[model samples]
Target chain A: MIKFSNVQLGYGGRPVLNALNFEIQKGDFFGIVGPNGAGKTTLLKAILGLLKPVKGEISFLNIKRGHKKRIGYVPQHASVDEIFPIKVLDMVLMGRYAKMGILKRPKKRDYTIAEEMLKNVGMEGMAEQNYRELSGGQKQRTLIARAMVGEPDTLILDEPVEGMDIQGEIAIMELIKNLHTEFTLTVILVSHDLNIMANYVKTLSIIHNNTLKLGPVDSILNEETMAKVYGAEVKIINISGQKVIISKIK
Target chain B: MNDFLINLEFFKYSIACLVLMALVCSFLSVYIVLKRIVFVSVAVTQISAAGIAIAFIAGLNPTLISLLFTFLGVAIFSIRFTERRLSNESRIGIAFVVSSAAAILLVSKSARGIHEIDDLLYGNILAATPFQIYLMIGIIACIFIVHFLFYKEFTAVTLDFEMARTSGIKARFWELMLYLTIGAAISIGMRTSGNLLITTFLIIPAANGLLIANRMKNVFIIAMTVGIISALTGFYLSYYFDLPTSPCIVATLFLILCLTLPFRFFYRKS
Candidate 1:
């Protein structure tokens, strides 16, 4: 479980996230939905301890700061230089940095785990391929595999499906779903696409004006809530037993 | 060629300088190359050059001024250009433009008798003094110490800083080391290779090394070897032809880089 109570973070002096409170429980596939600069990424960074909250406390399943390696992260794709010369297999091995210990080369067990994780992601064939050469979806899968190699209790993904085609998106969504069930891992995803969230995740949280509203999809997918949160009119329609938001008004 | 090769002290100094520069800059080259901060180093050297030029103009010790200005540049980068604010390349570009402009302005305003800043622009490695030798040794030791102390942190931060931080490594500390290492290299090597050519030693060798090697350790070794070879060949070629040493060295390194491109293609294909 991850808990953020009264979290407030800012740059220089201005606040980005203020009086923010959210808790994620075990086996929860929570999708964080928010507009740009809604502090969704900041919230994730806050949870990861990448940014310290000036006013609040964050506790992860009773674990302290140094012991949070059980938390795996797949940051936004924009954050990394994909043109880096490293191969796909090498990136997976990097997941063992915490366990490999400082100054020690990754051991045989590390390689074994890395190989197994790549196989799990169906990227075994492209193990030695340069990271820069991989297609967008494939790179995302490889990154996911890298994160999963750490075997974390909580897996956090910030827009893991961005820049992917429809088929690629579905494949990744399915992979995440399978991984969540297989590992019984708590998954936190930040995305702007409401349809993707409604279809794949068990719960969704909309972040607006530093306030986070989290609950089941059915309860929170109403017209009033969408209008209130997104400041846009959202017409919900049942299409072949699936809830779809037909259009979002200005 | 025979006359230049026969001078034992020249040979010794050139060889020693080549080895030290190769070892230090080869390791650094990859980080700068991967980070795409070549312009940053260039900008820093220009700024440091400007600082030195200004100090010379004002009748102050240029080396002291250069060091102070280098520290100031590092500090500015640390405070204003966090990983969040700017990519390493953009930050370096900003530094490059500002410093180069400042250097030009300072040079233009100073009296003709003020020390020629061009020497600092293109280095005088063949005429390196014992003081410069000691400075090189000190810089090399610092590089080794910094790399040894923060080997994992540097690798992790270089590869993925956010991941490094999440893994409980202090990324900012290692990043500071990287920036300091670059500053130290420029400060010590600026007199040897000047601002214009220093980046060549810092980048070319490492890039050539990366063409053949995949791992970081192998990359460092291969790059150092290439750097030494180019430096030696540059020294001999310049001496024999009675040519400018720094540009000759830079050209030799560039020639080698061009030669390696075909091998890279063949290796990739195979």
Candidate 2:
């Protein structure tokens, strides 16, 4: 479990998300929904320890000092250079670097775990293929496998389904959903896709105007709350027991 | 050919030194090209040259001074700049120009000004000594061992810097280690191989390998092979043709890279 108490996140001393207070419980499938420049990614960076909070504190309940390896992070797929000559299996093996320790190469067991994660993500056949050759969806899955290979208790995904087709999106979301249950991981996914988040996540956090609205999806995903957060007229309709969000043009 | 063959013993030390230098530079080249730090190499080389020129003027040991200056340059350039007004590339360009100017000025004031400049630019590898050869071999061996030990960390940082940091890999420390290693290599290599040849070795082999290789490991192996082959062939060609060793090696590397262009074309087509 992770807690952000009165946390202020920022760049160059300018607060992006001010006075943020939230707690993510174990085994929770949490989604963060926000518009462009709403500091969703900044919050994730703070959690990952890549950026320190400008003010206040972020504490992991059970994670000890120097044991921050309990959380696995999958940044946006665009964060990497596609042209770099890295193979899928090698990329996944990088996940074991922390556990393998410095100066020690990955062992047979590490490779097996990486392969199993790849298989879980439906990318076992492409392990030997060049990562650049993979499609956007496949690249996302490979990144997920890389994050999951360490067998962390929590997994953080940032825009995992961006730039993918609907089919690819559904496949990746379903894969994450299954991995959450199978691996018993506390999942925190950040995206702008309200419908997917509304249906897939039990609890959702909507970041707007440097504030957070956190609760169950059904309680926080209404049209009025979404319109206020997104600054657009929005509607949430139930289709086949799934919430579909549509934003009206001005 | 008979004259060259007769005096091959005199060329032995230079050949050994160049081949070892080539191996280290070529191996380091993969990271340089992939990380897009070619200009940093240029700046570091110029700084080392400036250090040598200053030593010449001050009557100090050139190797120690050059290493010190190169480490100074590395320290400056390796710092991650937060200011957006001056980008890293622009800063490196400024460093390159300033260092080159300083070298020229200092060399002009020295006793062997023009000769020293020529040696710094093109190198005098043909007159290398056994001590330099042994020193180069030792330094290169240490670099290779360190790289072998931290290979995964290097690859991870080069491939995805942010991900490596988030994964608790001490990305900055490893990156600094990489830059320092390159600094040491360039400084030592510049003593015998000269600026132009060392820079070429640091770039062309990796560029050639990246052109043809589909995997990272192959890229490294191909790069080292390209470097050694170029060094050996260039040494022979220079001996047979009565040309400069450094230029010949650089020319050979350039030609080899050009020859691999067709393979790249075919690769993209397939």
Docking class of 2: medium
Task: Please give the range of 10 consecutive residues that has the lowest summed lDDT in model 1 chain A.
Answer: A60-69
- Deviation (Å) of B17 in candidate 2: 1.9
Per residue, candidate 1 scores C-alpha lDDT tens digits across A129-195 of 8877788888888888878888888888989888888888889889999999999999999888787
For this target, which candidate reaches the highest lDDT against the unseen true structure?
2
Instruction: Give the top-scoring candidate (DockQ).
Output: 2
The 0-to-1 C-alpha lDDT of every candidate, in the order given, reads 0.78, 0.89
Per-residue lDDT of model 1, residues B1-270, tens digit only: 567657856567655765677667777887887766666666777778878778767888766788778877866665433245656667768787878777767777767523456676776566666777777898789788878766666767777888877755667776777888877777776656677666788889888977877766777787888888887788778878889777887899899999899999999899
Tell me which residue pairs clash in candidate 1: B43-B96, B123-B194
Chain B TM-score, one value per candidate, order as shown: 0.89, 0.97
What DockQ does each prediction reach against the true complex?
Answer: 0.34, 0.62
The residue-by-residue lDDT of candidate 2 on B17-123, one tens digit each, is: 88888999999999999998999999999999999888888889888899999999988887886555678889999999999999999998777879889999988
Clashing pairs in 2: none
Among all windows of 10 consecutive residues in model 2 chain A, the one with the lowest summed lDDT is A62-71
